[model samples]
Target: MFANIPTYWCAKCDDITQFSLKVKEPPQFTFAIRKAMDDASGPVIPYETNYCDFCCKNCGQPVRVKYDEHEFAMSSYRYLPKAVYLYEFAL
Candidate 1:
């Protein structure tokens, strides 16, 4: 159903990964998500943090990237990269 969403490269898995909105997993947030998506004027909450999680469809390894809806216009949304950064949390 979400095949055409977006894709990014994962160095750990050494392959391209698919993207998914973290919010979509929760049933309660569905209405908020829909509202945000339906709003043509702008994101329901400007500056809202939307996590764009990219994971390997094969191994299931995943990485999270932060994004703000106000960062890009709707027309430029498709051009956004699936992976923004590879975070190294602990030393």
Candidate 2:
């Protein structure tokens, strides 16, 4: 897991806040596919990615963070729109 916690600008909170991330490991099939790809193409797939879910503690807005294990870096972060969050929860 990545050691550093990332900060994002929270629109609801109106301030930069540190996101408490929860790392999710990739499925076993992902490793199998990666290994097959590597064997076929000589280390083409170097990193196994994991997902991290976080939310703005102040606002309860959810976000998804992606991290790369080999690089030990955060690849990207996406803030879930309020409408989407509400719709999913409503179901």
Candidate 3:
């Protein structure tokens, strides 16, 4: 269900804190633990996304993730609140 399951995310700091798009059913929620890292260069490297969790290194501030799926059949993108931009997220 890769194509059908379009999960979304939002970082608290930068990408240090993150969570995956949940079905919002009963006890339905997924989080992650894969912090981003630099590969030789100072540029940040991307990870194998589509899994639940946040890329800690990438997420730098403080964040609160929430999924906002509009197209239930196509793709989904989480709606990061403005507070997220100023969040002081910690592990």
Candidate 4:
């Protein structure tokens, strides 16, 4: 199993939030997926992504998480719209 947990800095609460990504595939395979995302000529592979929301352990505010076979990212609290830069993980 491959797993990575990264912290995201939240400007709203002035705190850091941690997110997780766990997959059975190896790092090399995930690298290929990210490569395909970067190269339009690369073949497309079907994958499933899921999102889960839970309250922050510290602030008691809702936190949204999005995860796929390769990575995971954290969104803003509750329904508030926010821009989360997730493509950087491809690098």
Candidate 5:
């Protein structure tokens, strides 16, 4: 359902052999993620991000990403990737 949510390339995790789904899908839920990326504070764990890939980092295998709402109150919403569409608004 969340195929339409936009994804941004996680440059930090990309440097590692395995990709991080948690880090990858931050921009989908909130604009703050984008702001954080551009923020000079450096890389921050996107806890406020709504959805997550339930991956087990120990074995280096691809695991199913799940949608968890409680961890992130502000992003406690989900929709099909297409339905929750956004436009490029210049700020």
Candidate 6:
């Protein structure tokens, strides 16, 4: 069984709706280093970060959700516009 997930207001849908959560994996890169004395390659290194994306089921609009943190509790969550979120993240 799946745990209860709360629905949020989707402006595009003009009503409350459930959102689908998708996790995006960061990009990976590989580098090669050559030694001055010999022609050899160095080890490969990988880096990545976790990112979450939410889409409204009714309207299929993407939104970025954030929780408001108070002194010791979370007050509420806000849906950020896709344009602003994309600009902020440079995605």
Best by lDDT: 1
Residue-by-residue lDDT tens digits, candidate 4, 26-88: 233355444433352233233444333333345534444444444345532222122232222
- RMSD of every candidate to native, in Å, equals 9.7, 11.8, 14.1, 15.1, 12.6, 14.6
User: Order of candidates by lDDT, top first?
Assistant: 1, 2, 4, 5, 6, 3
Please write out the lDDT profile of model 3 over residues 1-91, one tens digit for every residue.
3233432244333322223444221121123211221111122123212222222335333222322233434454433221121223345
Q: Which stretches of candidate 6 lie above 4 Å from their native place?
A: 1-4, 20-52, 68-91
TM-score, candidate number 1: 0.41
The digit string of per-residue lDDT tens for model 2 on 19-83 reads 54443322322454434333433321234544344455676555444444453347654332211
Model 6, span 1-91: residue lDDT tens: 1114645576555867553323321121112111210122112122111123444556645443332212333644333222212111113
| Candidate 5: tens digits of C-alpha lDDT, residues 1-91 | 4344434333334422233333644323345434533342233334432333222234322222333223335646443221111223347
Q: 4-50 in candidate 1: lDDT tens per residue? A: 55566666767776566543433323444434433422332444545
Stretches of candidate 2 off by over 4 Å are: 1-3, 20-47, 71-91
Lowest summed lDDT window (length 10), candidate 2: 81-90
Model 4: residues with Cα > 4 Å off, grouped in runs:
1-3, 21-47, 70-91
TM-score of 6: 0.33
Q: In model 5, where is the ten-residue run with the lowest total lDDT?
A: 80-89
Please report the TM-score between candidate 2 and the true structure: 0.40
How many residue pairs of model 1 clash at the backbone? Answer: 0
Models ranked on TM-score: 1, 2, 4, 6, 3, 5
Candidates 1 and 5 compared: the better one by TM-score is 1
TM-score, per-candidate, Cα-based: 0.41, 0.40, 0.21, 0.35, 0.20, 0.33
Residue 63, model 6: Cα distance from true site in angstroms: 1.0
